[model samples]
Target chain A: MKFGVIVFPGSNCDHDAYHVISKHVGQPVEFIWHKETDLSGYDAVIVPGGFSYGDYLRCGALAKFSPVMAAVKEFAAQGKFVFGICNGFQILCEAGLLPGALIRNKNLHFICKHVNLKVENSNTPYTSEIAEGEVLSIPIAHAEGNYVCDDETFHQLEENGQIVFRYCDENGEVTDEANPNGARSNIAGICNQDRNVLGMMPHPERACEVLLGSDDGRNIFRSLTKAIAAHG
Target chain B: MKAKVYVTLKPSVLDPQGKAIHHSVELLGFEKIADIRQGKYFEIALDATLSDAEARETAEKIAKDVLANPVIEDYRVEISN
Candidate 1:
């Protein structure tokens, strides 16, 4: 499947995502600039992490109004896959593709570290290869990854099985200490109601190589490939 | 005309920066303060031809739709002569 990685100005991880898709996942991928509004040719879109728009007025706030976001919204509405990581996650939420807003880290600091994430739901396209309740080590870097939404929306996400991943310890135990940013319910990732769109704080692309740290993130890409094949 | 917008986190939402500031203030011996909540302020200059009411309306709309995120924050707009 052909993948498109959206690149907004100040996006540092765009190349990393591109490398993971083309080199690691062995898929054809291209960079789609934020000014370009067309996404019809791509089967899937990956919004990589970075300080888009210099994180002005709040992270991902200004980037939401970029021309490409409108096209990205349309792409996802067609039931195509859209994966957003870190700042990309913030952008998705700002674009209303996903629920909740990412606020300042609870500690008021930019946290950069490898954290364990437990798969809460493995049935979606993004997490299909991951076993339920399995823990994967993923690196997260952000100062505003604290996810928050109203009680009603939070409940809706839970009831819909949209909460795909949660912060957890190495032993797969969810606890306060495991929550790196104090995200609501220790949520590390979630998908939309249709499960076609996913937004997560952890950077899976950063963990795709064993030499860098862990190759646990390759499972997500593998899952996506499998899901796309089945989708056809 | 000039318009000022104040955007603040909703009461139910947590404000980590504000919390840190509150703790610092307490440490500085200002123990009587009840709480602290950080927010953003924006001053916008509108077209000079617009009337005060028109500027106020425009500012209000901008505050609601653009300057503030309704999901986690509230905003108010004030127009000045």
Candidate 2:
């Protein structure tokens, strides 16, 4: 499967994402700039985490209007697979590609550490390799990783099984201890109504290598590759 | 024209930052204060001669897309004509 990782000026994780998709998933990967509008050649698109635009106008505010996001919206509308991690999640929310918004860390400080996330629903392409309620250790680093949504959207997400992951402990026990950053409902990730677009605050790429102390995140990228190949 | 947009978290949402600030206020001896909730304000300068409808549209767009996250925050725009 051909993958494309979008690189905004402040994107600090594009290379990490590309490395994971290419080396770990063993898929063809490309880097697309924030100003570019063409995305016809890729099977999947990823928006990696970073303080885009210095987090000045909110995390992903100014970055959402970048030219590349216009194409991303079109691609996402076509049901192409899209993943947004960390500030990428913020960007998706800013672009209206996702249902919820990422707010300041309830603690108001930059949190940088590993977190355990439970796979709430493993039916999607992103989490297909994992069993329901399985836990994966991944790192989260952000000041505005709090996820919030109105009752209507929140209810719809719950009803449609849109939530994919939530903060938990190694035993799959929900806890605020390993959460690092406080998010509503201990949410670590979620998808759009269509489930084609996913936005999560955790950095899976950071955990894809065993040298990083955990390879649990490799499954997510691998699952995407498998799903695309099977569908193709 | 210049307008100030106040972005505040919804009542149901938890504000850890505001809570911390409240604690600090009490420590600093403002004992009579019942509560403290924090908010952000942005003073936007629009170059155009904006009509009421246009101004409202801009503010709404910003509130929905930027200045505030509609998921957790309710925003108000005060315009200076």
lDDT per residue, candidate 2, A1-232, as tens digits?
6999999989999999999988888888999999999899888999999878988867898998899999999999888989999989999998889987887787789888888899999888899888899889888888889888878888888888899999998899988786666676788899887777999999999999888988989988888887778767
Model 2 accuracy (lDDT, Cα):
0.87
DockQ of structure 1: 0.87
lDDT of 1 by residue, A1-232 (tens): 7999999998999999999999988989999999998888799999989999999988898899999999999999999999999999999999899999999999988999999999999989988888999999999999999999999999999999999999999999999999999899999999999999999999999999889899899999999989888888
Q: DockQ for each of the predicted structures, in order?
A: 0.87, 0.60
Model 1 chain A scores worst on lDDT over the 10 consecutive residues at A223-232
* Model 2 residue pairs with clashes: none
Error of 2 at A42 (Å): 0.9
**In each prediction, how many residue pairs overlap at the backbone (N, C-alpha, C within less than 3 A)?**
0, 0
**Candidate 2 chain B superposition, TM-score:** 0.88
Give per-residue lDDT, candidate 1, residue A114: 93
